[model samples]
Target: MPSLNPASRERVLVLLRHARAESWGETDHDRHLADEGRADAGAAGRWLAEQGLVPDHALVSSATRTQETWQSLAEAAGWSLEPQLDDGLYSAGPDTVLDLVRGTSSEARTLVVIGHNPTVAYLAQMLDDGDGDPTAAADMVMGYPTCALTVLTFDGDWSALDLASATVTAFHVGRA
Candidate 1:
């Protein structure tokens, strides 16, 4: 956990959906990212660097595809942060995801979470306070494509995270 400043009001939560993965006839959890997925993951990382949003901590799903996505992103961004891989995030719902986020250490100001769809997309929709980029919000309504990254800002502690409590700062789909 990073050192916390009580006076710091802004916290960043970056929700990233795993990149496109191949079926490979393997179990859902065992599938890995496709070549395109790898490229997109790297692109996502580059975009994060361009935004100057470096995560102080990261929570990633245990699924193979998610892990691969994280690895690709890290390599591309030249980031070297050890992320916690949890099975609970594999098929978790939006509520569960929210709970996990709320449980994060307050010492961490920026947190990046990588997970599967539906849940990831659902979390973003539920948390946005409607004061963000209108175009991005509109694009999200259509769909949260593979490797999509949604950056959310909150002025409260992690324990206070809840539905509609964050302002959507940036929402980018696909590679930069």
Candidate 2:
């Protein structure tokens, strides 16, 4: 068991689903973020800003929708972060995504990962506080909606994070 006494171990990853997309596209993998999705990204960005939650690093999917969502929020915040196009994220499940984060630079604090769902929703629900507003992530128990965010905290080295150990913080959607 890892002790929760390392300040450097507090690496937070705020996982979010990109905003609503108008089209599902020809294939599920090819869908792009909709206009509403763009708006949702901005809205989420503003809300995050208000909460004073700024991620030090971001990992995004290569899908158009995911990229657009990531870019929109970055623009809204006037942040010029270099986001890597993780192909693994484009088709990974919650476990794979969690592993990806755990493999990141140990020095990086506060990471944000933007991808599609059921992974996002499942991951959130798995690491939730058990008391956040369901409306904030209403479908997480069933499914996650577009533009939803599930914030989690872990008091251990990112390399050692596990589904059973992370603490849920906020599963936010609408404005606070």
Candidate 3:
């Protein structure tokens, strides 16, 4: 983990939604992570673990691909953190997304959010700082390819964050 001030112990985090996924019809919300998406999730998870960015808690969309993504990520990173499955996140907008993040408990310093696009893409754009590798972040800005990740950071607990209080510090996706 990067050096965060003690004041930052009350963290506000927003994990980028995972990459591509099968359409809802094919797999429903519980069975959507494709083979490729699985690999991508692993890569993204490894990246997160390597950075010591593991979350104490996770907020996941109650969608198959999203759940599958987290499963693969947990497998790769050896993380056993508890995650809440949220039905509300399947097609929520950015404001709801912010609300989901803010819902994290005060004692939890880190949080991971897994969900669908448009909202995730928009959130990444809002939080990105251009400090991470440009080439790596290109997919995030251009499009969130399946299983991609946009890691972000903030100074306070989730509720304290506004639009400008965060920044995307890194982006990751499995190589094809």
Candidate 4:
């Protein structure tokens, strides 16, 4: 994890929904990303880099598509951190995912979570404090399609994060 100034109280949380996946796999958890998904993931990464929102740490679902999305995105973004893959994330709800976020280390100022929707989408909406960029929030309301991501800023520790505790700063749907 990239070390941050301990005195800084603000933290960035990125919620990402995994890109499109092939439908013919034996199981959903084992399904891999489609060609379009790979391209979209790369696009998402480049966009994030341009925004200077590189994450210090990442939490990803153990499902193959989510793992592949993270790998492609990280490679395109030139990020060199190892992501934590949690099997529970494959089926976790918004509250379960929020609990996982709360367990994040304080050393990480920017964290990313890659998982499935509507969990990811719901979490992003749940965190909004109604004080962020109105345009971004409006865009998010349209729907969280494949490779969609939301950037939120919060004050205090990750453990203190809750509904309406964070402000949605940006929202985008990466496509290629």
Output the number of the TM-score-best candidate.
4
Residue pairs that clash (backbone atoms under 3 angstroms), model 4: none
Please give the lDDT score at residue 16 for candidate 3: 56
Clashes of each: 0, 3, 5, 0
Looking at model 1, the pairs that clash are none
Better of 2 and 4 by lDDT: 4
Question: After aligning candidate 2 to the native by TM-score, how far in Å is the CA of 28 from where it should be?
Answer: 3.9
What are the TM-scores, per candidate, against the unseen true structure? 0.93, 0.83, 0.83, 0.95
Candidate 2 has which clashing residue pairs, if any? 21-34, 22-34, 139-143
Best candidate, lDDT-wise?
A: 4
lDDT by residue for model 2 over 96-163, one digit each (tens)? 99898888777777788998888888777766655544454454565567888866667667788876
What ranges in model 3 sit over 4 Å off? 1-7, 10-14, 23-31, 128-139
Each model's lDDT: 0.87, 0.74, 0.72, 0.91
lDDT (Cα, 0-100) at 56 in candidate 4? 87
lDDT of 1 at 169: 72
lDDT of 3 by residue, 1-176 (tens): 34322244546364656655665564466557667778878887777777776678898988877888888888888899868999998988888888878777878777888887878878777665565446645767776766667766676677776675676556666544
Measured on C-alpha atoms, candidate 3 has an lDDT of 0.72
Which whole-number lDDT from 0 to 100 does residue 71 have in model 1? Answer: 96
Candidate 1 off by > 4 Å: 1-7
What is the Cα-based lDDT of residue 34 in candidate 4? 99
